[model samples]
Target chain A: LAKTTQPISMDSYEGQEVNITCSHNNIATNDYITWYQQFPSQGPRFIIQGYKTKVTNEVASLFIPADRKSSTLSLPRVSLSDTAVYYCLVGVPSNDYKLSFGAGTTVTVRA
Target chain B: SAVISQKPSRDICQRGTSLTIQCQVDSQVTMMFWYRQQPGQSLTLIATANQGSEATYESGFVIDKFPISRPNLTFSTLTVSNMSPEDSSIYLCSVEDGARGTQYFGPGTRLLVL
Candidate 1:
């Protein structure tokens, strides 16, 4: 498993764009970078996933560089409801039987 | 995304007791997983439930302490035996759709042991 490093917490104002970056220097070739958002008393929700380059969805966008050493999750116009812990995981698709989680970045979107 | 539900959303148990958390998925899934999240900490994978066979446990987690049962594709149960205050945490059940490498999770069962 590729260990990830991220900020312990981040603060963003409403209507502002917030970007959280994760470092996975030991990522493997078959690994895909996935991001999840977890709210209080709730399970982590899939926000975005990408193998390389940029992948955009209705909820968020994932940017991965060619080296695959790191990735960034960009949330445009964040709101108070977006306050939650965001986890970044790297795993081989077929071999992703278990996800090793680290202390996720807790993003607090304020007014 | 699948709709998953767990019984007894929250419970308080006495030490040496056991609690079995039930997980039900709205649709059949190929893989089901159990996780434990300690307060102020991240989630930890407990085991992977396999239908009709023994579950695969992770390091530091034994079947005797965390027994898992996947009776079918749509339901599974996790029994936390010999509970202690250290065992107090939120237990979550997740399902993999096998569609886009995404896993959906349940609301989670909050357990407090005294």
Candidate 2:
């Protein structure tokens, strides 16, 4: 499993764009970079996933470079309800049964 | 996408008593997972339940403490055997939809062993 490092917490104002970047120095070739959002007392929800380049979904966007050593999760027009911990994971699609979650980056959107 | 559900949303039990947590998915999935969440901490993988075979447990977990059963692809159960104070935590189950590679999770069973 590729080790991931991220910020412990971040503060953002409502309607402002927020970007959380994760660093995985030893990312593998086949690893897919994925991000998840978890609210209080709730299960983690998949936000965005990408192998390389950029992936934009209705919820968020994932930006990955050619090296694929790091990825950024961008949340546009953040709202108060967007306050949650975000997790970044690096792994292949199959046989990687374990979903290793780190401390995660807690993003708090203030009014 | 799959909708997952778990029984016994929350329970308080005495030590040495076992609690069986159930996980049900609306559709049949090839891979089902069980996880434990300690208070104020990240989630940990407990085991993977595969249909027609024994479940594969992660390191630091064993059948004696966390016995899991998967009779079919749509459902599974994890029994906390000989529970202790250290075993108190939230138990969750998840299943992946192959087409989108998205994993859906249940509401989770919160167990408090005293």
lDDT of each: 0.93, 0.89
In model 2, the runs with Cα more than 4 Å from the true position are none
Evaluate fnat for each of the predicted models and list the values in order.
0.69, 0.48
lDDT of 1 at B94: 95
Question: Who wins the TM-score comparison?
Answer: 1
Q: Give a tens-digit lDDT track for model 2, residues A17-63.
A: 99999999999987888898988877788888899999999999999
What is the C-alpha lDDT profile of model 1 across A12-104, one tens digit per residue? 999999999999999998899989999999989988889999999999999999999999999999999999999999997657557788899
Give per-residue CA lDDT, model 1, range B1-114, as digits (tens).
799999979999999999999999999876899999999999999999877889999888999999898999899999999999999999999988576676889999999999
Candidate 2 interface RMSD after superposing interface residues? 1.6
Candidate 2's TM-score reads: 0.96
Q: Clashing pairs in model 2?
A: none
- Candidate 1 stretches with Cα past 4 Å from truth are none
Binned by DockQ into CAPRI classes (incorrect, acceptable, medium, high), candidate 2 is medium
Model 2: how far residue B90 lies from native, Å: 1.1
Candidate 2 lDDT score at position B22:
94
